[model samples]
Target: MTISPLETLQRVFGYESFRGDQQAIIEHVVQGGDALVLMPTGGGKSLCYQIPALVRPGTGIVISPLIALMQDQVDALLELGVRAAYLNSSQDWRTSRDVEQAFLAGELDLLYVAPERLLTDRCLDLLSQGRVSLFAIDEAHCVSQWGHDFRPEYLGLSLLHERWPHVPRLALTATATSATRREIADRLELNGAPHFVASFDRPNIRYRIIEKNEVRRQLLSFIKAEHEGDCGIVYCLSRARVEETAEFLCENGIPALPYHAGLGAAVRSANQARFLREEGVVMVATIAFGMGVNKPDVRFVAHIDLPKSVEGYYQETGRAGRDGQPATAWLAYGLQDVVQQRRMINESPGDDAFRRRLGAQLDAMLGLCETVNCRRQRLLAYFDQEIAPCGNCDTCLEPPQAWDGTVAAQKILSAVYRLWRERGQRFGAGHLIDILRGKPTDRVKQYEHENLTVYGIGADLSEQAWRGVLRQLLAQSLLAVDHEGYGTLALTDSSRDVLKGERTLMFRREPEKKARSTRSASARGKDAGIVLPPDAQQRFENLRVWRSEVARGHGVPAYVIFHDATLREIAMNPPASMDDLGGISGVGVRKLEAYGEEILRCVRE
Candidate 1:
C-alpha cells in the first residue's frame, strides 16, 4: 500500500494543506531519501520531520542540541497525541530507565536525545538495539565551524550514520550561509544528501535598524507608535541589561518579564510559561530563551545591542511575528556596541582560524545594519534564497525620503571634533544632542560658549534625526565617542575626507508607518492558515486521542496512523470508520491494510 504526502499532512498533523513545498519535501523524506532543510521559525520545519516519522516503519531518532529544545519537541508531540519522549539532564534515573525500556519495546515513535548524550556508550548501545528509521540532526548548522552557534558535540553526531548506513538522515537549521551550509554537509557526511533550500525571505517581518540614543524613550516610542498591546521579545546583551530593560518596560505600563541564565529554575520556568501562555508580555531576555519555542504570535523582537553576528541577529529577530502577521525586527546600534562586540570576539580563546571566521561573521552582521537595500531581499540572498522586495518592512511599506546628508554629516562630524578639542573629552548622546542644539547651560558654558563653527549648524535638523546620523557614523567608524570623559564625541579617521567634500553621506530620513491593525497575518495571506479556533480545536483534539490509541494498538505511527485534519474532518463528519475512512483524504491504499481496522475502532469507539 502507498500513501501520498498530502494524506499524511492532513490526517496526522491536522492541517488541510502543506506549507510551501512541504508536501514535496515530506514525500522525498517519506520515500527514505536524505534531506537538508533550511526553513525559518514558524515555517513548519518540524512537520517535515514529524510527518516522516509517522510514515516510516521504526522510531525516528532526533539528535538535538539544547535540552530546552528537546523538551519543547516532546511537549508538542504529546499535545498532538503522538508517542514521543526525550532524554536529557532534566530526566531522573527511573524516568530515563523507563524511556530506554520504551525504546527497546518499540513503543516510542520519536526519541529526542541531546547530541552529547547520544555519544555515550550506554545510549549508543541502546540506539544500536532499536529499529531506527531516520536520524534527524536539528540545529544542523551548529556542526559547521562557520555557524554562529557551533557545538563540537554536534560534529561528533556524524558517527551515527557511519554505524547505521541504511537509515535516511535529515539536517535542519533556521539560518545558514553558503560557507556554513557546505561545512554542515561535510561535517555531517551529508555530501550526497538532497538539500531543500526554502526561501529565507521573512516578508512579514519589518526590519528597522535604528541608532541607540535615549533607549527608554526610543523603545517606548517605537512600542507605542508601532506595536501597541502586541506580544514582543526584547533581547539585551547581558542579564543585568535584561532585568533593567524589563523593569523599565514594566514601569511604563507594558507587561514585561526578565529571563536570563542567572534566574532560578522555578522562576525561569514560570516566566517562560507566562510568556508562552499569556499574551502581551514582552519578555526581556538574554539569548538564553527561545531554543525551540513554538509560540506563533510573537509580534516584535527588539535588540538593545547589536547581535554578535548576522546569524544570531537573523535567528533572534526571526522570533517576531511568527503568526505571519506583520512584525518588527528592531535593533539599536551605536559605536559603543561595535566596540563591545569586537572586544568580545577578540577576547575569545578560539583558534586563529576560528577568530578570523568570527570576525567575518561580525562584518556580515554589520553589513545588514548598514545596508540601504531591501532588508528582506538582502537577508534571503545571503542564505542562497532569492526574493524580491518584501513590500512590508518599515522601508518597503513607507519608504523614507532622503535629502543631501553631505552637509549634515559634515556638521555632525565637525561638532564632535570641536567638542573633543575644547572639552578634551567625550560626553553621552544627550550632551552632544544638547551641544548640537546650541544649549549654553553650565556644561556648554563651562566648555567656553561652545567656541566652534559647527556648534549651532545642526539646529536645522531635529535632535532625533541627528542622533541617528551620529550613531550610524560612529558605528561605521567615521565618528568616535570618547567613553573616558563621560562619552564626549570625537571624529574618526574618515571625518577628514567628509569635510574635504571628497566623501558624500547618503541616508534615509525617518520611515513613516500607519497604525497597527487588529487583523491577523493569515488574513493578509502571509502566514499559513493553520490556526484552530478555540472550541472546535478542543473537540478535534479529543478525537485525535482516540485515533492515537488505536494506532498504537496496530503498531503503526499514529498518522500512518491518522492525521489531525482527518480526525478534525472525522469529528466534524463523524466518519464511522472502514468504508467511511476511504472518503477521508489520508486513508489511502497502504493505510487501508495497515490502519483500516484501527480507524474503524477509533470512529466506532
Candidate 2:
C-alpha cells in the first residue's frame, strides 16, 4: 500500500502540514521532477526530501557535506522508525558492508553519503545496483567557489544526474545569494530544475552588534545576565582566540569547551558530543564547528570577532533559535577587526580578482556593522530579499544617532594626504590620530607631525570617537590600508571628494554603554523566553530531566529523542492517556509505540 505525502508526514514525522514550499517541492520530487530549494536553517528543508523518499518507491540518496553529523541524522530518523543509514569513512568495514547490503536489499528508506565518498567509483557501482528514489544534495551552496562553505567535492555532483537520468535530484541550501544560487544550478546541472527561494529571515533571532570594549567582560556579562545555563556557541577568528575564550569562560564559571582543527579528532568529537547531549555546554570554536549541528535548543551564537562576509555571518547566526525560541546573535566589532581583515586580504595568496572578491565581501559586512538603518533589512537585502525594518534588531530597538562627519572625514583624509605628500611617509591609525588631535606624543614629536595642516582639528572628539571616524572612513573607501603589512592608513581616490567638500558624510555615533540594571538582568534570566504557568514550567523541567536520562541511555542527543518544543507541548496539554499523547504533533506512530506510555506516566507524575 502506497502512502500519500501528507499521510507520511503525519504518520512518520508527526507533522500536520507542510511549511512554505515544502509541499510543492516534495510533490515535484515525488513525481520524478528535479528542484533547487533555498530555505532558511529552521525552515524544514530536510522534510522536503525526506517525505518524498518515504512516499516514493525506492530509497533516497542524500549527498551531504557533513560526514561528522551523519550518525546523528540517522539516529534521529531511526527514532522516528524510518529505515535510514549512512555510508561514510567513520564506519568499519563490516558496518559499511552491512549498510551496503541493506541498501541493495531495499531495506533502507534514506541513505546519506559524503560527496567525497559518493564520487568514488565503488560507491557509484553500489548505488547503481540499488533502486534510487531521488538524489538530495544538501548544502548545495558548497558548489559555488565564492560561497563561504565551499566544498570542492561538490563540483563533481553534476554526475549524479548524468549517471541516473531517471532519478529526480533536489539540491538544497540554507544560505546563498542570487549569484551563488545561479552558480549552484550551473555547477550541479540543475538549471532545468525549478528554483524555490524561501524568505531568509529568521525572526526568532534578535541581532545585536556591540562595540568591542573589554569584549571578554562584555561576553561574560551577556551570558550571565541573559543566557545563563543555556546552550550557546562563541565563534573566534583564530584557534588561539578560541582556546583563550574557552578558558576565560571556564574560569569565570561558565562551562565552555574549545573546538578547532588544532585539537585531536577524538577531542573534537567528544566536545561536539557533549555539546549536543549535555545542557548548557557552550562550545567556543572557530569556523571549523557548526556546519551540520542538529542541536535545536541553542539559545545564542556569539561572535567575539568579526566574520569575513555577510553570508558567513548570517549562516553562523542562523544556527541560533532553530527551535523557534527567542535567541540572541551578538557580535563585538571594532577598528582593529577592520584593520586585521584588511591586512589579511592584502596579504592573501589569491590573485587580484580573488582579492577584490574578498574585499567586496568584507565591505558588505562592514556596511552591515556600521549601518544606522535596520540590521535585518540590510542583511536580507544582501541576498536580494527586501522587507520593512524589523523591530527585533538592535538598530530598531534603539535607533543609533547619525551625525554629520564631513569635516571629520576631510580632516582624516587631509591628515593621510599631508603625511604622504610632505614627508613621503605613511603612519598607522594611532600616529595619525595623535597628529589630528595635536597630541605631542613621542612619535608625533619624532616625526614633527604636529606641523601638519590638519593638526588639532579633531581635538573636539574623544579618542574613541576619532577612531570611529577613521573606521567609517575606511569602510566608505575614503581611506585604505597599506599592503606593506605596517597597518598604515592611506587615502583612496574617493578621498579627494571628501577633502574638497563635494561629498557629505554621516556617521553612526556609538551610544554610551549604560550599566545593566539589576532588576532587568534578573528579569531577562528568569524565563529566557520560555513563558509558562508555574505547574507547566515544573512539568517541562521534569520532562527535560527524563529526556536527558533517556538520551544518555540511547547514546543520542536529547533532541533526537524529542525536541523541547514537543516536550513543551506535551507539558502544556498534559496528555492523560496513550491515545492523547499520540495525538500530539511530534508523536509519530513508532515513537508512540516506543515511549507513549512512559510519556503518559511522566505527565501524570
Candidate 3:
C-alpha cells in the first residue's frame, strides 16, 4: 500500500513521467514541506499537488473559488478511480452532509470546498475532526487586491496556515507577476515556502497585435481564414459589447454564445455547458469569464479591447493551446482604446496611490504594445523575464520598419494645439489625422480646419501612417487624452520637446491595410502540424467522435474521457488488445478496465 508518487502517476493517473518541476514539488510536499507554485495554465500544476495528496496520510483539502472548477476537477479525479468529492452551494444540504460524513469517515482522498464555505465555523470544525493531508490554494492570484481576478473571500484563506500549523500548504496560480506573487506569499503567510517559478513561455501559442481598423471585420477574417472550425474565446471589455459581438459572430456563421454576469444564472450555465460539451463553439465574454475553464482545445483567444494590465492579458491568452497544440493570442487596439483605458484608470474609485499603481500597470501594457522588439520578449520582460526573439509573433515574423517621425509628430501635435488652444475646439484622432494628412472630409470642412495654419502642411504620410505616429506619441507620453472633450488629443509636457525640435521621434511602420493570408500559428509547432499520415488522421478523428459520444453519455467534458493527445497516440499505434491499450500514456488500470475494450473496437473500425 506504500505507493511512491511516480508509481501512483503511472498506475492511477496514467502518465509515464512528471513534467517540469512536478516531481520536485510533489516530493517536497509529501515530506511535510510548504510551497508556492507558479506554473503556466497548461503546465501540469495540478499534478504537483494531486500526487502529494494521494501519497500523503489523510484527505487533501482544496480551497477553490468557483463551483464549476471544483466539479470539473472532482469529476476528472473520479474517472481516474480516486475518491474525490466537492462541497459547494451547488449541492443541496443532504449531499453536502453526505460528503462531509465521507470525509470524516476516511472514505475520501481529496475534498474541494469554496473559500467562502471553508471559512464557515461548521466547515472549520469539520476539518479539525479529520486527519487532514494538506491544503492547496488554487488560483492564488485572487488573493491580491491589485490583481485582475481579486476575490474578497480569498483574504481569509490565510487562516489555513494559522489554524492548521502542522499541515503543509501549497498555493498555485496560472498567472502571477512578481508583485502579485509577492503579495500572495505575504497575504497567505507562505513567504518562507519553497517558490517554484516555471518559465512563462508558451511556445505553442503565437502572439499577434494589430492596430484596430474595424473590430468585427478583422475578427471575422482572422477566424474564417485561420480557425473556421475551432473552439475559441473572444474577450470584450464590456458586457454589452460581449452580447453584440456574440450575436455578430453567430450571424456570420460562427457558433458563438454570450457569457456575462448580466445574463440569468440559468442561461449562463446553459451557455457554458454547450461550450464545453460541443466542439468549435466560440464564447464571447467579458473579464467575468474563463477562470476555471478546463477545455483543452481552445485554438484561439481574441481580445477586442485592451486588458487592464499585462498580467490580465497573459492570463487571458494563456487559456489557449492548453493541449500544447498550435493556438493564437490575437489583439486589436487603437488610439481610442488608449484614451478609454486612461480614462478608466483616472476614474477608478481607488485612492491616489492605488490609481498610481493602476497607471503603472497600464504603462507596462502600452509598452508591450508599442515595443519594436519581439512581442514575446517585451511581454516576458514585464515579468522580469528576458527572452530571445520568439520568431513566432507578428513582430518577429515580419519586423516593423522604423523611421524618423520627428517632423510628422510635430505636425500632429501642432494640429491638436491649434484645434484646442488656438481655435477653442477639440477633436479626436480622426479629425487631427485628417488635418495632418490633408483629407478633404466633411468634418474637416465643417470645422474650417482646412484653413488652419497647420492644415495641409504635412501630407507626406498616409492616414494609417499618421495614426501610427500619433499612437506612438501617446505611448511615449508625448501626448495625453482630454477625456472631458470626448477623447480629444492633448499635449503633454514632453510634447514641448518635440514641438520645440528638442527631441527626435522614432516609430514603427504600421501593418498593411489589406489582410494577408498568413499561415496559422499552429503551423509553427511540431505537434500542430500533421503528426500522422492520412489514414492515421482518419482514425484519430473517428476516435474523437467516439470519445465525444461517450462523454455526452457520462455528462462530462470530452477530455475527461480521453485527451486528444492520448487518442492520437492510440490511433497512430493502433492498439491490438486491452493489454496494448494499457501501455499508452494516459490509459491507467482503472480506465483500461472501464473503456479499453470499446476503444480497441473503435480502432478496429
Candidate 4:
C-alpha cells in the first residue's frame, strides 16, 4: 500500500538515482532524523530536501531567506511535475490564498517560506493543522553573525525546532567557516544533529591576485587578452564604483551590466536574468547580488575591490566554473582598500563585538591577498582545513621573481629625499619614478630636477619592476601614500631599515614560464574531431536511464552507484557479465551488489 522512496523519486522526479550523499541524507530524514548539508554550488543541495519531502508522509516545509530563491526552486519543482508552491512577498493576494487552499486540501508536497515571514498567524495555523515531514533551511550560513554574510532573520529560524520538535530538519549552506559552523548549530537549535561536510575547496577555479595599479589598463588587458567572451562578475565596494566600472568596461567594448542595491528591482532582475541566459555578459555588482544565482557556466569572477572576508570571496568565486570546466578567480588590491575598510570600521556605530570579528576576518582576507605561499594552501589553511601546495593557482603555475633591492631601495629613498629638497614631498610613485628615470615631463622641468644627481640613477630597471618595488615598499610599511593628497608618496619609520639595508625586498618573478599551456591541441583546431562516439552516447543515455530508474526507485543519485566514467565504460563495452561491471572503477562492492542485476537487465534490454 505504501510507495518506497525510490519509486517516488522515479515516478515523480523522472530520475532513477541520487547524486553523492543525497540518498543517505534522504534516508536519514525519511527515518525522522535531523540533517545538515554543506554542498558546493552545483552539487545539488536542493534535491537532498526535495526528494525526502516527496517521500515522507507529510508536507515538507522549506525555510528559505530569499523570496526570489524560493520562486526559482518552486518553478524548477513544478517543471518536474512536483506539487510544490511558495509563500512569499512576491506572490499576489489571490496566489497566496490559492497556496493556502492547496495546503488545506493536502495538494502541495513542498512549501517554501521565508524565515522572516514564517511566524505569522496564518502560516502557523496552516502548519499546526498538518504533520510536517521535514524543515529544510536553505542558505543556513546566514544564521551566524560571525559569518561574512549574516542575516538576523536566519537567527530567528531556530523557533522551528520549538514549534515542531518532532519534525525532521535539514540545514543547508554552500559556505561556512568553523566559527560560523558552531554558531549555526547553536542558533538553529540543532540539538546535536549530525553534520555532512563536503570539501570546501573548489579545484576547478584558478585563483590569481594582481597588484592594483593602472587599474583600467590592467582590467582591460585581462579582459581582452585572457577572458574575452566569458561571463564574469566584477565586485566593487560601493554602488558608485559598480556603476562607474560597469560603464567603463562597456565603453571599452565589454558587454557589462551593473547590479547593486541602488538599481531598481525590475532592472536588476532583468540584468541578472539576461546574464544567466546570455553567454559572455559581464555583471558588475556589490556584495548584495550573486546569492542564489544559479548560473553554472560563469567563466570568471574578478574582484576590482577587496571582499569583506575570505568566505565571501570563496562563495562569490565559487559561483564560476560550477559546470566543472576550468574557470578563474581574479582579484586586484592596493593599500587604499585596506585604509578605506579600516576607516569604515572605525566609524561604524554597529555592535563592538560584530566590528571586532569583522575586522579580524578582514585581516585574514588581506593576508590571503598578500601571501607568498601557494594561494590554495593559504586559503584552505584559513578554514582550518589542509591541502598540499595546489599547483593550480597563478603563483604555483608562474611565480613572480624578486631582487635584493638593498641598493635600489637606497636609490628610491634618495630620490624621494632629493625631490623633497627641491619640490617638497608632494608627488606619487610616478613623479618619483619620472625623476629617477630623468624623464623630461614639464613638472620635472619646472622642478628643475633634470640635473639632479639621483636622476637616471634607477633607469637600469624596467617600469614594471620599478612599480613592483614601490608596491612592495608600500606593503613593507617603508613608504606610504598620503590619501588626502591623492596618494603622494611619503617615507615611513621603516624606511630607515631600507636605508641601512636592514631589510632586503623579495618579490615574485614576472610571468615565469609556466606549465599552463592555453593554446593546446584542444584549443586549436588540431583536435577538431567528431563530437561523441554514437555507440558511447547511446550507451551513456541508457545507463543514465537505468541508473535514474534505480535511483528513483531506491531514492538516490544515479552517479552514486557508478560515476559517468563508469557508466561510459559500461556503455562502451556493453559489459557481458558481473565481472565486467566490477572491473570498472567506482563500481565498488556495495554498488555491485545493489544494482548489478538492474544494470545487466538494462544492458540486455
Candidate 5:
C-alpha cells in the first residue's frame, strides 16, 4: 500500500497540514518534478522535501554542507521513526561502511552526504548500483560565489542532473537575493524547475538597533532585563572576542559557552552538544556557529559588530524565534564599524567589480542601521518585498526624530577638506571630529588645525551628535575613509553637493529620555503580546523542565522532543487524555503514541 505525502506527514511527523507552499512542492516532487525552493529559515522548508523523500521509492539523497546540520537532521528523522543516516568525515571507516551497506540494502529512507563526499568515486559507485529516489540540495545559495556561504563543491552539483536526468531534484535555501537565486539555478542546472519563493519576513522577531556606548554593559542589561534565562546566541566578529564575551557572561552568572573555528574540533563538538541539550545556555560565537543549529527556542540573536552584508545579517538574525514565538534581533553599531568594514573591503583580494558588489552590500546594511523608518519594512525591502511598518521594532514603537543637518553637514565637510586638501594631512575621525567640535587636543594643536575656520564650528552639537552626523555622512556617500591613509576622512565626489549647500542632510536624533523609558518598561514586561497568566506561566516552565529531561534521555535536541509552541498549547489547555493531547497542532500519531500519556500526566499535575 502506498502512503500519500499528507498521510506520511501526519503519521511520521506531527503536523496535520502543510504550511505555505509545502503541500504543493511535496506533490510536485513526489510526482517526479524538479523544484527550486526559496523559503524562510523557520518556514518548514525541510518538510517540503522530507515528506516527498519518504513517500517516493528508494532512498532520498540530501546534499548538505555542514556536518552539524546533517547530524541534526538525521537525529530528528530518527526520532520521527524515519530511517536516516549521514556520510561525513566525522564517522569511522567501519561505521561508514555499515551505513553504505544499509543504503544499498534499501534499509534507509533518507541518506545525507556532503557535496565533497557525494562527488567521490566510491559514493558514486554505491549510488549507481542502488535505487535513488531523488536529490535534495540544502543551502543552495552556497553554490554562488557572491553568496556569503559559498562552497566550491556546490559548483559541481550540475553533474547530478547531467548524470541522473530521470531523477527529480530540489534545491533549497533560506536566504537568497534575486541575483543569488538565478546563479544557484544556473549553476545547479535547475533552470526550468518551478521556483517556490516564500515571503522572507520573520515577523515574530523584534528588530532593534542601539548605538554603542558600553558594549558589555548594554548586552548584560538587555539580557537581565528582557531575556533572562533564555537560550540565545551572541555573535562576535573575532574568535578572541567570542571567548572573552563567553567568559564575561559566565562570570556575570549567565551560563554561557564559546564556539568558534579556532577551537579544537572536539571542544567545538562538545560546546554545540551542550547548547543543544541544555536549557537557557547562551552561546557566544563567531559567524561559524548557528547555521545548521535546529534549535527552535532560540529567543534572541545579538550582534556585537556590524555584519559584512545585509543578506548575512538577515540570515543570522532569522535564526531567532524559529518557533514563531516572540524573539529579539539586537545589534550595536557605530562609526568604527563603518570604518573597519571599509578598510577590509579595500584590502580584499578582489577585482574592481568584485569589490564594488561587496561594497554595495555593505552600503545596504549601513542603510538599514541608519534608517529612521520601520526596521522590518526596510529589511524586507532589501529582498524586494514591500511590507507595512511592523510596530514591533524599536523605530516603529518609538519613532525617532529626524532633524535637518545641512549646516552641521557643511561644517563637517569643511573640516575634512581643510584637513586633507589644504593641509595635505589625512587624519581619522577622532581628529576631524575634534576639529569640527573645536576641541583643541594635542593632535589639533600639533597639526595647527586649531587655526582652521571649521574648527569648533560644530560646538553647538554634542560629541555623540557629531559622531552620528559623520556616520550618516559615510552611509550617504558624502564622506569616505581613505583606506590607504589609515582610515583618514576623505571627501567623495558627493561631498561637493553637501559642501555646496545643494544637498540637505537629515539625521535621526538620539533616542530621547521618554522613548528610552518607554522601551525599558516594554522590555521589562516579558512576552508582552503573548503574555500568559500566572498559572500558564508556571506550567510553561514545568513543561520546559519535562522537555529538557526527555530530550536528554533520548539524546536529541529539546525541540525535537517537542517545540515550545506545542508545550505552550499543552500548558494552556492542560489536555485531559491521550485523545485530547493528540488533537494538538504539532502532535502527530507517532508522537501521540510515544508521549501522549506522559504529556497528559504533566499537564494534569
Candidate 6:
C-alpha cells in the first residue's frame, strides 16, 4: 500500500497542506528528479526531502554540516514516530554499529551524517549497501569558497551523484545570493536541476538598529522592557566580549551562559543543552553557536558588534521569530564598530582581490545600517528579491529625517586633510571630534590643533552629532581608517569631491532620546506574542508546565515534544477525546497513539 505525498504529509508530519513550492519540490524528488531549493529559516525545508524519503522505497541520507544538532533532529523525528537515526563522531562504537546495522537491515527512514563523515570511504560503502531514496545536502552555501561558514568537506559532495546516478539529490540553504547559488550548482554538479527560491523575508521579525550609547545598559533595557524571561541570543565579535557580556548580563539579573569555541567541549555542550532544555536561558555567544540551533521560541537576537555582511546579518537575525511570533532583531552600532571592521579587513591575510571583496561586503552592511529607507527592502534586494517597504521595520515605524550634511562633511574632510597635509600627522575620531566642537583639551592643545582654521569652525554641533557625521563620512568612503591599528582617520580619493563641494551628502538624523520606561512586568507574555483570554492563557501555561515535565522525562527539548503553537491551539480548542486531539495540525498517528490521551487529560485538568 503506497501513500501519496499529501497523505504522507498529513499522516506522518501532520500538516494539512504544502507551503509555497514545497509540494512541487517533494514531488520532483519523489520521482527521482534533482533540485536546488533556497528557502528561509522555518520555511519547512526539511519536509521537502523528509516526505519523499518516507514515500519512496528507501532511507533518506541527509548530509548536514551541523554535527552538534543531529541528536536533536533525530529526536524530533522520533517523536513524530518517524524511523530516524544519525551517524556522527559523538556516538560510541556500539551505538554507531547499532545504527549501521539498522540501516543495513532497512529499519530507518532518514539518516543524518556530517559532510566530513559522509565523505569517508567507510560511510560510502555503508550507504551503497542500503537503498537510498534521496540525498539532501543541507546548508548548501557552505560549498562556496568565499562564504563565512565555508566547509571544505562540502566540496566533495559532487561525488554522490556520480556514485549513485539513480538517486535524486536536493541541495537546500536558508541564505545564499545569486552568485553563491550558481557556485553551489556548479560545485555540486547540479546545473540541470530545477531551482526553487522562496521569499527571503521574515515579516515576524522587527528590525531595529540603535546607536551604541552605553550599550550594556541599552541591552539591559531592551531585554527588561521587551523580552524579559524569554530565550534569546546575544552575539559578540570576540571571545573576550562574549565572556564580558555574559557576566554583565548575569550581574544585571539575567540568566545567561557564555558559548564560544574557546570553552571546553563539555562546557559548550552543557551550555547548549541548558539553553535548549531549560526555559528562558539566554546564550551569549560568538558566531560559533547558532548554525544549526533548532530552538523555535527565541524571542530576539541582539548583536553588540556589526556583522561582516548582509548575508551573515540576515542569517543571524533570521534565527529570531522562527515560530511566527513577534520578535526583535536589535543591533548596537557605533563609530568604533566601523573603525574596528576596517582595521580587521586592512590587516587580513588575504590578497588584494580577497581584501577588496571583504571591503565590499562590509560596505553593503554599512549601507544597511546607515540607510534611511526600509531595512527589509534593502535587505531583500541584496538577494535579488524585490518588495515594497515593510511597515514593520524601524525606518517605516518612524521615518528617520534626512538632513543635508554637505557642510558637516566638508568640515570633517577638511580636518582630516589639514591634520595630514599641515601637521604631517594623523588623528583618531576622538581628537577630531574634540577639535571640531572647539573642546581645547590637553591633547588638542599639545598637538597645537586648536590653532588650525578648521578647529573651531564646527562648534554648532554636539560631540555626538559630530561623531555621527564622522561615521557617515567613513561609511560613504569619504574618510578611511588607517591600517596602523591606531584607529586614526584618513581621507580617501573620493574625499576630494566632498571637499570641493561637488558632492551632496544627506545623513540620518539621530532620534531624540526618551527616558527609559519603568513599566511593570505584567506585559511580558503579551510582549512575547502570547495573547489569549484569561482562562485560555491559564490553560496554555498549564500545558507548558506539563510539556516541560514530559520533555525532561524524555531528555529532549520542550519544543520537540510539542511546539508552543500546537499547545496553544490545543488550549484554545480544548480537545474532548483522542480523535479530537488527533485532528490538530501537529498531531500524527504515532503521536496520537503515544500521547493523545495524555494530552487530552492535560487539557481537561
RMSD of each: 6.4, 1.5, 2.0, 7.3, 2.0, 1.6
Residue-level lDDT of model 5, residues 1-605, one tens digit each, is 88999899877887788888999999999999999999988999888878888999999999989999999999888877889999999999999999999999999999999999999999999999898999999989889999988889999999999889999999999999999999999999999999999999998899999888778878887788678888889999999989999999999999999999999999999999998888789999999888868888788899999999888999999898887777889999988888888888888998999999889999999999989999999999888899999999989998998999899889888887876678788788888788888897998888788899887778898888888888888888788878694988788999998888888888888677341223343233334336678899888888888888888898888888888788888878888888778778788877788888877777777
Please list all clashing residue pairs in model 2, or write none if there are none.
none
The better candidate by TM-score, 4 or 5, is 5
Candidate 2, residue 262: the lDDT equals 98
**lDDT by residue (tens digit), candidate 4, 523-550:** 1211111134787767677887776676
Q: Worst 10-residue stretch by lDDT in candidate 4?
A: 521-530
Q: Any runs in candidate 6 off by more than 4 Å, and if so which?
A: 516-527
Tens-digit lDDT track of model 2 for 63-147: 9887677888899999999999999988899999999999999999999999999999999999999999999999898899998
lDDT of 6 by residue, 287-316 (tens): 888887888999889999999999889889
Question: What lDDT score goes with residue 393 in model 2?
Answer: 87
The C-alpha stretches of model 4 lying farther than 4 A from their native spots are 1-17, 350-356, 402-505, 512-605
Stretches of candidate 1 exceeding 4 Å from the true structure:
1-6, 30-32, 208-214, 217-230, 251-253, 325-373, 412-463, 480-496, 511-605
Q: What's the lDDT for candidate 4?
A: 0.75
Regions of candidate 2 where Cα sits further than 4 Å from its true position: 518-527
Give per-candidate clash totals.
14, 0, 0, 22, 1, 0
lDDT values for all models: 0.74, 0.90, 0.88, 0.75, 0.87, 0.90
TM-score of each: 0.77, 0.98, 0.96, 0.75, 0.96, 0.98
Model 6 Cα displacement at 92 (Å)?
A: 1.1
Model 6: worst 10 consecutive residues (lDDT sum): 518-527
Error of 5 at 433 (Å): 1.2
Q: Which scores better on lDDT, 2 or 3?
A: 2
Candidate 3 local lDDT, residue 340: 86
Q: Is candidate 5 or candidate 6 better by lDDT?
A: 6
